[model samples]
Target: MKEKVGKQSLKFENAPYIIGAASVAGPKEIDGPMARYFDRVSEDPTFGKDSWEEGESEMVRQAVMLAIQKAGVNKDDIRYVFAGDLLGQLIASTFGIKDMEIPVFGLYGACSTCGEALSLAAMTVAAGYADNVVAEASSHYGSAEKQFRFPLEYGNQRPLSATWTVTGSGAFVVSDRESEVCIKGITTGRIVDYGVKDSLNMGACMAPAAADVIYQNLQDFDIEPTYYDRIITGDLGKVGKKILTDLLKMNQVDISDNHMDCGIEIFDNEEQDTHSGGSGCGCSATVLAGYILKKVSSGEWKRVLFVPTGALLSTVSFNEGQTIPGVAHAVVIEHHEMSKGK
Candidate 1:
């Protein structure tokens, strides 16, 4: 009956099923490999809005509404919405869902907001606090560049290490209703700093945190790396992917065989000319909603360790020459059949 597992983890006795999920992506993403999997795609980067920020809000709104509709649930039936975006004051999310009138919890874990939101949603539903809830995260490439790096108008040359921020939003309807996939457990991560101050190179900043959490999850569950069919990371791109595997290998926990990075999967580095890859909250969120869940639901991948990594840094902190610390949260997602016998 004990839900508390090991340090920094929880085993839910009543795992919440993901009744519905949706992904809304932008123009550039529409050309990517996973484009066909997205529920909604727009050729306009502004999403018919005047500004990039407003467009991002529209994406969030569309995603949440679509997810609710897919779940076949009335908006009033949902008890809470855990959502966020990579914007100051969470303006994107606030404006996006304010009119919905659902109780809301705005979260910010940089690009890892999706994982954080999902983890909290699972915990809340597992505790019998609510019958249904929505967890979503969004990020806009134009908005992110305006806030973090230089403006698109500046026409600055990005380094090869730089990653393109995804312009999209993903939402999930987590409820007590039985479904094809569910959240089994979670392993929360702590902020870890390697003192790397490169604002452009997020892979270097986040790989350490991803490695730490994945290692802890394996140890806490007393299982090997192969316990999950695939070990997924948020936005570690190519450079960070190498660093993550190398770090885990040092601990004798190798996930190289099944390791997959959302950043790497979202875009084709060569044709898209996206430099390293995609990096943003939407990167992992959309991938999970559009692609990963399908595989799990089809029983192609029975279980997956979804770890979304975040580089904790603001323009203010980066301008002050602060190191970009990283954090990652891991959610155990499995097929319903896998949990049936247990």
Candidate 2:
């Protein structure tokens, strides 16, 4: 039987299989460095929808449909759809997946929605609560900009510390049945607030939370930094990356050799004007679906620690001058070939 691994972690004896994953991104993302791996790219910013919010919904729906099709499972076969977005009340997830006719559990973890959704979906399958589930997340540049900052028409100067919001969606189908990619374990994060009030620099606000989770996972499992081929974080841009590395160094665990951030990997610094990098639910979700999983499937990476970080702030709270808190969740994915060798 599957059992709890350690503090804040769960061991999946069945190791819920990642049957398939799909990424759908906007035109700018489609032209980014990791563009080739995405399943679908929308050339239109609105994606033929009347509004940016509606466009985000389309991306989620398409991603879900594509992932299900790739998994070779009927929509009816999925027991539940676990999804979320940066938008208020998960509007994107609710309206986007409504047509699928599958039961859903809407989640909100800021940019870490992907990781949270994946962890819960894996746990549900591992615990025999479900046979298959779809975990998905999305974000849109225009909608997030208008909601969080000034509208696009304002053309407010984005400081170097500000990261661009990604316009994309990613969906993953996790099942109890065997597959090429499977989830081995998970480390759920805690809310950490360092009293940072600057809404522009999300990386700085979320780095501490990411570091804490990484350190906790390591200590709980009695593992070294070199245990995995890569220790990947969601969207903690360049600034957060340094903070996380410095924090880990204090803990006597160095991950610089293998640490990679999805935000840093997604865009070319010089070519793209994405200041620090990308941030949003889609930033890490799309990267995980389009890049990391593909790398693992090819046997290039044996095991990986995929952590997605999120800044817990809203327009109301930020406007009221509340500090931005952050959280992160970890998922350990291993390839079938690697599992066989073990």
Candidate 3:
């Protein structure tokens, strides 16, 4: 049986393994620092589709199929799929997996959808509900901008704190099978609002929630920040990175030495002009599938706390003058070699 740790965490009795993972990114992302790490990069922003939304769905399909292929498993063998995107009603994820005929649970956590999907997939497998499952998340710059902000044709100027939404998708196959990387535990976050109203500066809105979860994870596990080789956040750009570190320091839990932000890793801010950095569901998802997993599989990183953060505010909420509450979900990933150390 899984042990329910303090407040909002779970310690798995039979940790689930990430047997395979895949990342599919767009041209903009291909030009970024972690470009070579992606499984596939499409030169076409439309992904051969007529619309940006359709292109995003195609990216999701490519990622999910490739991950299954890498796992050497038949599509029929996949019991369920947990996926979502930064689109209304999860249309992107729906169209992407509709033809596969697998049972699916559409989720939404803004940029944190990847962590949320992965956590639920791990829990399902750990609880013996299925032999194998797929977890995926996606985001596209064009579609996100059209829905969340202004139209592409508008060409509105962005503030320095604004982050570029990543155009990419990442998928993973989780199973009880032995593998190099496994999920040991999870610490789910609660909605935290600091009365921040600026949607452009998402880092400020999400910093409090990220801090809350990190603090709780440390307390629940009875460990310090140094317990893991690294603590990675999803899309908290340059601004969020500073706020996150400072908030942790206030709690006497310092993680500055080993903290990494996917947003910061994906792009060269100065060169790319991606002011703060990258945001959206794909930012952390793609980095984890492409870069972080490689480090863990090769034993360069023994353990990691993967926390994807999100600023929860829709265009409707923003226009309606509602505060942007933030949420983050943390997953504890470990190398198979760590089993021997234990």
Task: Give each model's whole-structure lDDT.
Answer: 0.95, 0.92, 0.94
The weakest ten consecutive residues by lDDT in model 2 span 333-342
- Could you tell me which residue pairs clash in candidate 3? none
Model 3 lDDT per residue over 1-342, tens place: 347999999999999999999999999998899999999999999899999999999999999999999998999999999999999999999999999999999999999999999999999999999999999999999999998999999999999999999999999999998889999999999999999999999988988999999999999999999999999999999999999999999889899999999998899899999999999999999999999999998889999999999989899999999999999999999988644543
Ranking by lDDT: 1, 3, 2
Backbone clash total, candidate 2: 0
* lDDT of the structure predicted as candidate 1: 0.95
- Look at candidate 2 and tell me the lDDT of residue 157: 93
- Writing each residue's lDDT as its tens digit, candidate 1 over 190-239 gives 99999999988999999999999999998888999999999999999998
Clashing pairs in 1: none
Give the Cα error of residue 252 in candidate 2, in Å.
1.0
